[model samples]
Target: MCGKPTARPGRGRPPVYCSRSCQARAYRRRRQPLPAPGSPPAPRPTDVRARQRRRIAEAVWRIAAEQGLDAASMRRIAAEARVSLRVVQYHFDSKHALMVDALRLLHEENERLAQGRIPYDMTEPGALLRAVLDEFLPLDEQRAFALRVFTAYYARSLTDPVLAEVFLAAEQPLERLVADIIGVGEAAGSTAPGIDRVHEADLLVSGAVGLGLDVLHGRRSLADVRTVLEYHLGRIFPDAIPTSRPNPA
Candidate 1:
């Protein structure tokens, strides 16, 4: 007999094997017993603090994106994560700490996605420049959310020293990377003659940031931003300018 209990009185034909699926499962189990529950369930794999931290950080990111970073309080984040308030506090001592962690997570994820999109060869300085700068543009939902959070934090950093330090520290590496790429372009003669690579890098980065904000605010579209970037790149690398004529079919 199947393990299921019989239904009372006239419910049905005592429900043999629960259903066709259960009947099949019982037949299979009877043929070969299950592999003895693997050493008392192997310690149950607890959620651990790392997972909690990631969950809390993601909750903060979502809340910050949907309703400004101002709304990402410990209580709100805890509620969003379906965990107790103490859990959030346990992982992050302060709201600023939580925000910083969230920002770091978002930055890491964006960087991974951007790096995946880049090509291995760096021969075309113009193409490399476009690829690098294009990483900052909010052309999709994930990038848009990242841009929003960055802009929000940047605004806050203007008035808060701690956040200002964090923002500047996070930006330094990117500035250096862009400057290096521009230096490569200049060396290859793809960039304009005698151009200040560092200053040009700063200009490109600042422009991308500002343009990203504009796209997020609806003042400019992704296409518009790409057009501007193309024009800007052409100015630095004349050979990179795209033709105006449409390709023939």
Candidate 2:
């Protein structure tokens, strides 16, 4: 006599397949396609990290944007990612480490967006200046959020020396890049006559920070920031005037 089929353990439903043999028999009956041997196995998607890290980063940014940096704590971030807090902590050693990573990610994203769009040749004048302006202006949602998070961290850093050190270190590359661009514009005769490269770089960084703060505080809308940048660009690098040499007078 054949053995009777038993009900499944959890839901109390009859087993679809009585045993391993039954499963194999059913599967064999269903035709399945097999790929050609040398066809590279469908290339196995290259975006695994992109999917995971992007999800994590999106959650981090969303938390940062909506709740501010403190709200982006490990547990909060993990909850946002729908993962265990330990998982978030495992990936990043601490809140400071995570913040550093977030900032670095934001920096990379901005660089990617600004690359090639910014001209390499300073001799071109307006084009190079526009590139510098483009980086400072938060023209869209992504840029806006990045700048917002950056500004938050920057503010937090004022009292936290560790955070400040990290923030300033991250900003050094950008400052250097700005200095180089200013130097080029000055050399190319595209900047204002009396503009000091170091001084101007300082002013531009301050202005960018101010613009970001204004947008963050509702003092100015994103569109207003854009307009302000346009106005400043025109004043800073007027097409009619030649770049002025530093005067001894």
Candidate 3:
């Protein structure tokens, strides 16, 4: 009867495994890699190659934002993105290359957004001035964050010549746009007759960069910053503003 199907002692509590190996097998199946206390959860493993490359880039940006550029290493970025060191290296050949790509991506995105917001043509001197100057302010949340990221990258570029080159590449379109505006101002006879166009164009770029940085750092309000920019524009194009009452803001 016992061999046929008799109930064993402690069967009410639980059935004993037939052998220790079975129990060991069950425990092994249950084991998993657990995150340590206070550790962040890991990213999922699906489509890991494409996803981890993007994640590593974003992690580099976040680390740069929080801890500064010196701390944003390829290994650290891979850890933050929760990918293997080989993955980040696979995506980018080296740490400097990774940083260069990341900064280039950021610069390209910023230019795209800024370009999208411009509605004025270079032929329209006054309108072009307003459009170019508009980008120098944090008119909305996206622009505000973009300005922050731009300033961060610009500061990092001081120590990274390759990054500086990438940044200048990104700025070429805007510089050309400025040159076009200066040409319009010259054709319209609005700009000072004696002013050197090339020098003035360079000055305008420097003014835009400096004024934007000042406003970003809270050294001046947007209204005050606009006034300063208009002052520079007026110097460049004395006749651009009509003598009649300007439009209300």
Instruction: Compose the digit string of candidate 1's lDDT tens values, residues 68-145.
Output: 788888899999999987667756767888888787877777778888987635677777788778778776677888
Better of 1 and 2 by lDDT: 1
Candidate 1, RMSD to the unseen true structure:
15.0
Question: Candidate 3's residue-wise lDDT over 67-177, tens digit each?
Answer: 677788777898898977765665675788888887877676666787788876766686676678778677666666667666777888888899899977777766667
lDDT of 2 at 205: 73
**What pairs collide in candidate 2?**
193-244
Please give the CA lDDT of all the candidate structures: 0.76, 0.66, 0.71
lDDT for predicted candidate 2 compared with the true structure: 0.66
RMSD of each: 15.0, 12.9, 15.7
* Top-lDDT candidate index: 1
Off by over 4 Å in 2: 1-54, 221-228, 240-249
- Number of the top candidate by TM-score? 1
Task: Give the least accurate 10-residue stretch of model 2, judged by summed lDDT.
Answer: 240-249
Residues 118-171, candidate 2: write the lDDT tens digits: 767756655565566656656557767887777767778898887677667766
